[model samples]
Every structure is written in C-alpha cells, then in structure tokens.
Target: DPEKLSDAIDCAPRGERFDWLLSVNINGEILSPLMWAIRDGKFALAEYVIDHLLEIRADRHAYYYGREKLFEKHPEVVTVLCSDCPALMDTLMDGLMWHSHSVNQGF
Candidate 1:
C-alpha cells in the first residue's frame, strides 16, 4: 500500500507532479515521508523523500509549507543528513535541476 502511494505519486502527469508530491504532508497519518524515513533510520529512503521534496518546482505554496514545516520539525535535517547519510548528498544537489517544464510561469 505504501509503494502503491509512491507509484501513484510517480505516475501523476508532469503538470500535476508537484501538486501530488507536495500534498504528501497531510495524508491523514500525521507523518510525512521524510519523517517516516527518519523514524525508521532508513537513510536511503530519507534521501529519496528529500529528493521528492526538493524537486525545485516553482510552487510558492509548496515552498512556504516546506520551509515552515520542515524547519519547524527538523531544523537540523541538513546536519543530520550530512552526518548520517553523506553518500546521499547527491540527492540534495540533484534536486537543484531546474524544472522549467510545467512550472507556475505566470502564477
């Protein structure tokens, strides 16, 4: 069922991808994907979740929520990742790939 959710999020159209990924925070379980990864000590999965989150879409809504919630709950996320999952650092860099397609060009 969890994989199914991931698959559904992945299979969403490019135009809607950010919307789907950004909505993962409030999926009725009170835990975001990254939180789950961290809770389980799944560093690789944490990297994956970080990649999905830092997808670099021009979504002000997503950006603001990400800033507030992530900083509020996991203010030391970067430090933790650096110490615990250094090999996964590429995910953070990779997320910087500009997603010009399907962005909020006007909004």
Candidate 2:
C-alpha cells in the first residue's frame, strides 16, 4: 500500500502541486515506507522529496494553505501526521498532545 501510494504521489502531474497538500495532510494512507525509511536511516531521499514539497508550497506563500511554517514549527508533526500505522499513531498522538499541552500551559 505504501509503495503504491508513494508511486502515485511520485507520479502525479507537476501541474497538480496542490495535490501534494492532500497527500501531506492525509499521510496516514501512505506513511509506512516513509517511516521505515527514516527509521532505517534512509532519510535523505524522503527528506529531499519533502523539502521539495515544502518549496512548492512556499512558492505560493500562503500560510492558510501551505506547509512551510507548519513544518518549521512542528517538524515532528510531519512524521506523526503521516503515519498510517495505528501503533505509531498512538505514539505520535500521545507525544504531540503532551507537547501541545505543555506549550499551551506555557502560553
């Protein structure tokens, strides 16, 4: 499923840059390969592609729709949000909720 999803994301038309937003937002559908790649120390490929996606969004320069600042503010959130696995989701949610709570408390 990850491979299929990754292929789809990779093969999407260049004109459909906005579609990447859907993939990034609903990453739970295709996050395993990415997580595995990162865990296995193969982050360069994933990070490079991610950076390009960020650049595409940045070129638009719209906070309400793009992901540059979001990624900058919460890089870990990317990993968590993109995870489709339930176990990983639980772990990510727990960590993210705790972090958010702490930040809110600080505020």
Candidate 3:
C-alpha cells in the first residue's frame, strides 16, 4: 500500500505536501510490493526497487538477498546492475570487505 500511500500524499489537499515523514510511514509497505514484484519475475519491478534502494540506501540485507534471488532466477538482471549502475557493485564489494575484515578480526 506504499504506492497507495504515495498516491495519498500526491493527491492530498493542496495544503498537504509529500515529506520525509510520509515516506517513512509508507516505506515498509512500498518495499514489500517491490519485493513481491521482483519475486514474481518482473524485471521492471525489480529495477524499480533497485533504483529506490540506491536512492534510499535501504537495508543491505534486503538489497543483497533480492539481488541474489533475482540473479538466481534470471541472470540477465546482473547485466542491468553491472552496466547501468556499477556503483552498486562497489558498494557491495566494500561491504564484503568490511565483513571479511570483521570476521578475521573476530577470529
């Protein structure tokens, strides 16, 4: 219902404006729909989620899991991420490195 929440903000009376509060309120719902769309093999929907995630710096777990799931189901999505938004690879790599360092330190 995030899209609906977005719609609500968009269609709110002229005095009401879309703000961070509204986005915060609806992010979970919005993310759910996007996740479902990706699971359903909808590349465009997955792309939409990717774009939003990049913009929001959303949860890395969700991002990684969704990307991995989509790649397993449809490898072509990897090309989209690599070619269109290579920055994501850097971000992922950085996270991996940090995690590796943390694990090594712990050990």
CA lDDT of every candidate: 0.58, 0.44, 0.40
Q: Write candidate 3's Cα lDDT for 67-88 as tens digits.
A: 3333344456446446555544
In the range 1-107, model 2's lDDT, one tens digit per residue, is 34544577667555454345233544455433344444665545444334434443323534222254335544675455355333344433333322244555557
Ranking by lDDT: 1, 2, 3
RMSD in angstroms between candidate 3 and the native structure over all alpha carbons: 11.5
Clashing pairs in 1: none
State which candidate, 1 or 3, has the greater lDDT: 1
The superposed Cα distance between candidate 1 and the true structure at residue 21, in angstroms, equals: 7.1
* Best-fitting candidate, scored by TM-score: 1
Stronger candidate by TM-score (2 vs 3)? 2
Cα TM-score of candidate 2 = 0.32
* Deviation of model 2 at 16, angstroms: 5.1
- Specify the highest-lDDT model's number: 1
lDDT of 1 by residue, 59-98 (tens): 4444322333444656776786687777666776565444
* TM-score for each model: 0.47, 0.32, 0.27
lDDT of 2: 0.44
